[model samples]
Target chain A: EAGVAQSPRYKIIEKRQSVAFWCNPISGHATLYWYQQILGQGPKLLIQFQNNGVVDDSQLPKDRFSAERLKGVDSTLKIQPAKLEDSAVYLCASSSQGMTEAFFGQGTRLTVV
Target chain B: DQQVKQNSPSLSVQEGRISILNCDYTNSMFDYFLWYKKYPAEGPTFLISISSIKDKNEDGRFTVFLNKSAKHLSLHIVPSQPGDSAVYFCAAIWSNDYKLSFGAGTTVTVRA
Candidate 1:
């Protein structure tokens, strides 16, 4: 079985510039998630989608970050006016069900200059 | 508030020894706990998991022990191999929620 897939394993952008990361989860998986992992810290949940509907996004910074999973198969996360503090690895994961083990993709490491 | 905590940032053990990593969580609502191993430049992969009702669960050389009363859990790797040297993260989730709360990982190095 194939694992979760993400694009542009690495990215760099200047401060205040906009950047976007894409993710394609495992086939047949209904639950998708986005997380941010800063250096020396664990992955922090940014948002969660259950079949194209948001399950939770309380931690998401609406002022700068946004994500969507349309059609429930693929998702995208975007950050506008990126800040230096936003430099981190953005991970995408999917699970067969809400309570199952999640499989993660090789994250997109964003470096804001 | 940090819901999950992994106190040890790093650990080094000689090959063939046992490597123990600890984690504590403040949320009692979490019913499912999991361990994930990650290599540099790679995303974390699920290693093992245990439910709240079970005190222990084992898979191959990896074992997960849960102490509900203490809100503590641990992962044990026996006969640690160089390949086992990596960052290990502990995560938890409530049955009703799809989101997972993760602990700052513990990096384990097995010296040959």
Candidate 2:
């Protein structure tokens, strides 16, 4: 079985520019999550989706960040007017329904200058 | 207001020694705890976990102990090997939701 897959392993953008990252989760996994990991810090949950429906997004910056899991298999996370603080690794993970363990993808490293 | 914290930024241990990593959380509602290991430029991989109801969970050489009353947890790796060197993160999930809150990771170096 394949693990979660993500595109554009690294990205560099200027402040005020927009950036997007894509994720394809493991087959049969119903729970998908996006997380932001800053240098020297642990990953922080940005949003979570369960079968195309958002389960939680309390930490997401509504004004600048948005994500969608259309069709419930692949997902995309976007950030507009990126700030310096937004430079971090964006990780995508998936888990089986009601499962505690999450399988993660190689993250997209975004650098906003 | 960081809900989870890993006070030690790094630890160094000789190969065959024990490596203990600590974590503490402020949210009492968190019932599920997990540990993840990550190498440079890679996403974190699930390591071991312990639920709130259990005081300890062991898997091979990895053991996790949870202290619900103190809202603290620790991971112990016995007979550490050079291959075990990596950044370890402690994460918690609230009982009401699946969202995971994580602490700053601790980098462990098991030197030969």
Best lDDT among the predictions, by candidate number: 1
What DockQ does each candidate score versus the true complex, computed on alpha carbons?
A: 0.84, 0.76
Q: What are the per-residue Cα lDDT tens digits for candidate 2 across B1-112? A: 6899999999999999999999999999888999999999999999999999999999999999999999999999998999999999999987566778889999999999
Off by over 4 Å in 2: none
DockQ of 2: 0.76
Q: Write the per-residue lDDT of candidate 1 for residues A1-113, one digit (tens) a residue.
A: 88899999999999999999999999999999999999999999999999999999999999999999989999999999899999999999999885558999999999999
Native contacts matched by each model: 0.78, 0.72
Name the lDDT value of residue B36 in candidate 1.
96
lDDT of 2 by residue, A1-113 (tens): 99999999999999999999999999999999999999988898999999999999989999999999999999999999899999999999999887878889999999999
- Distance from true location, Cα of B34 in model 2, Å: 0.7
lDDT of each: 0.95, 0.94
Q: How many pairs of residues collide in model 2? A: 0
Off by over 4 Å in 1: none
